[model samples]
Target: MQPSHRYTRLTAIALGIAGVISFGSAGATGFQIRENSVKNQGRAFAGSATGQDDASVVSNNPAAMVNLDTTTIRTDVTLIDLTAKFKGGGRSGAGTPLTGGNGGDPGDATPVPAMSIVVPLHGAFEKLTLGAQLSAPFGLKTEYDSTWVGRYNAIESEVKTIDLTLSAAVKITDRFSVGAGFVYERAEATLTNAVDFGSGICANPQTRPLCLTPNPTAAAFGPQKNDGLAKVKGDDTGIGWILGFQWKPTDALSIGYSHRSEIDHDLAGNITFTKPGNVAAVFAAGGVTTYNNGPGGAALTTPSTDTVSVTYAFNDQFRMMFDAQQTDWHSLQSVDIKRANGNLITSEKFEWDDTMMYALGAEYDFSDSFTLRGGVAKDESPTNDTHRTPRLPDNDRMLYSVGLTWNANEHLSVDAAYTRITIDSPDVDVVSSSSSTLVGKFKGHADLFGIAAQYKF
Candidate 1:
């Protein structure tokens, strides 16, 4: 077959495989758990020891569940709005430039939801407890208009993830407790873009007749059209485990620690390349062109991960929490494509590395029914400046939060919290060789609203 035909067919297969994996995974973003309890917001999230809160206690340190006085059930819901701004940056050179345009503006917003429930096995097993939780640990969504000028690298992209967990807590002694749990997770993602071939260079038809050589660009573009969109989706399921321990050396002092193991996922999906008639006609008008055919094969593998958290409580009135996490991003080095006829096409290597994050929080009691909390955290950027794309122009970020809890009555309580995140713009280099750098910066801020109901029987 002609090179153009081979390229189109291969790309179509890759897009298809990616789409299958993304959709099957349930659209997970892997954004991380922002809230575990109404009270947790105050101490930054120190519930590992003073597991007074029902939901967070189970997810953060299940062993603490053995201390419950009665069987209690709780649920919380949170809404988040994020606004990102891009500033600075200029476009130079004439080749269908890859960067520039409203280089500074607000991007998009994201919303997240979570829930958990815990029960004590008192009569038959006084020292044993069981609990379950549903949360979103990682996720993000971003879309840049095609006219934004960064279209060559990325235009629109979104990722969403969900995790369901079941846990058991057991008390080893009056002063020590241990626990373990299992997790089921799902994820999904989508990316679309239209790369440009400058009118003078690749598009010139004259100066370089072979400018349209059947290479990576031709294989990716095909005869379907010079400008088009590649849509891909993927999904998968995976298993993970968690272990935790808590120590109460004295009535006034408590210490706790927990570790969660990572889960590996293999994603499968479908991809579709849509081109304008002008572009498709170039290959074969009203018929199959070297580009109009479907390629249909590709796969992505995401590796396992780990997280550690520690909590310390001084008396029943005050507490503090610390958390750290590491992700195996290196596993995402490249997207491998396989043709149905058993052939290897091109590979897209991201060459990503591991990343780490840190967080701290504290809480204080104001009265029997009122509590106050505050926390701060720092998160590192995952992408380097060389490969940064508008789909996720993220940089290192700082977070600040405050919260309150009110005991409305013996059987009821109310919780509320607010958090803000700040990000700085980083210098970015586009794909174009001559016009490599773009002048600009990015900023983002968000607000959160939450409410939860708890009851004891």
Candidate 2:
């Protein structure tokens, strides 16, 4: 059986929503979040897999939990301030100059929080440890002026997630330990953009004849004129697994390795459009489907990651650490959206490349109660110039960090950390099917401040 015209129209409208649903930004790279632990962030996460300094290890390397002798709890929060601005010009589908100011600073400050608890077993299970953690492993947010020259490309884009992890670790011997974890993550996204109803109608072969005639509707709407609004919202939950091992070959050195599996989600939601009065009249007069609202969904995959870290203690008062990590961003070759009946609506191309991040750090015991920390890192971006867009103008970046740890008492400690990320300016040239060619350069940076407290019982 053939689909109805209304069904077909809904499919077409949903395609536009899917097109912009692929938007994202990154605090780490490609929308991954890395501010789960203030103590780790202080060292640019260099020794995360082997640091084992607090309960945060439950999420970084569960195997390291074998080193915790008592029950411990840790909580942390980080305030991230991001700045991304665009300087450029654009043209409409009709090859006419698009007019509007460069969108104002589209970046905003956001807070990320996390918590973890670890408990050591007693008696026959003395070598066993169990843990739980709550964190945001991936997220992003960006908003542009509604009337900006690139409005047709994107206006607002946001993605948020919450992850809960249950983990276990067992000491096989004095020198080796292994661990594993199960994760349940929930994700949601909301994106918006302007739609050129005039150009879209005139560009459609089925409707072009109507547009060419002496119709008041055609006269009132043309190219960049009579714009409508499109919005898409979706949410889903997924599961993944984590495996890791920590090895101590000598009293002064610790080495760790960890791997996280990928997660897949089929986000379900609705797409809605708001048309102007003139456009509504035109659609009504021509007996065209209004393309108002309908069900839609998209399939997304959170990439996997692998990391290796080493921490060396030269003396009781100081130590140095190093980490190398890689993300399998190739899993994101494309994003495909579908209708409620399972028919494909559209697919957006990404072709992202896998990337790696490296960091080095050191800690110095300044006194019996105070420790100082410093670090640096190089974070690679997954997207290149050809695939970059206004919704996500991410680029390679350098990170510099410093922090302090205070042991207030035998059972309590506090950590404070700060970091600056400098991003390289990259040019963007996005050509739209609607004839809107957005050409420009982007400047971006971020500052992060974090604090955490840990207690042992």
Question: Which candidate comes out best when scored by TM-score?
Answer: 2
lDDT of each: 0.58, 0.81
Q: Across residues 162-248, which tens digit of lDDT does each residue of candidate 2 receive?
A: 999999999999999999999999988787777777676656666555456576554755777768787888889999999999999
What TM-score does candidate 2 reach?
A: 0.93
lDDT of 1 by residue, 341-371 (tens): 5467556445556666676888788898987
Error of 1 at 291 (Å): 5.3
Q: Model 1 off-target regions past 4 Å?
A: 1-33, 36-38, 45-51, 88-94, 98-100, 103-107, 197-226, 285-308, 328-330, 337-345, 432-440
Candidate 2 wrongly placed segments (more than 4 Å) = 1-22, 204-218
RMSD of each: 5.8, 3.3
Worst 10 residues of 2 by lDDT: 1-10
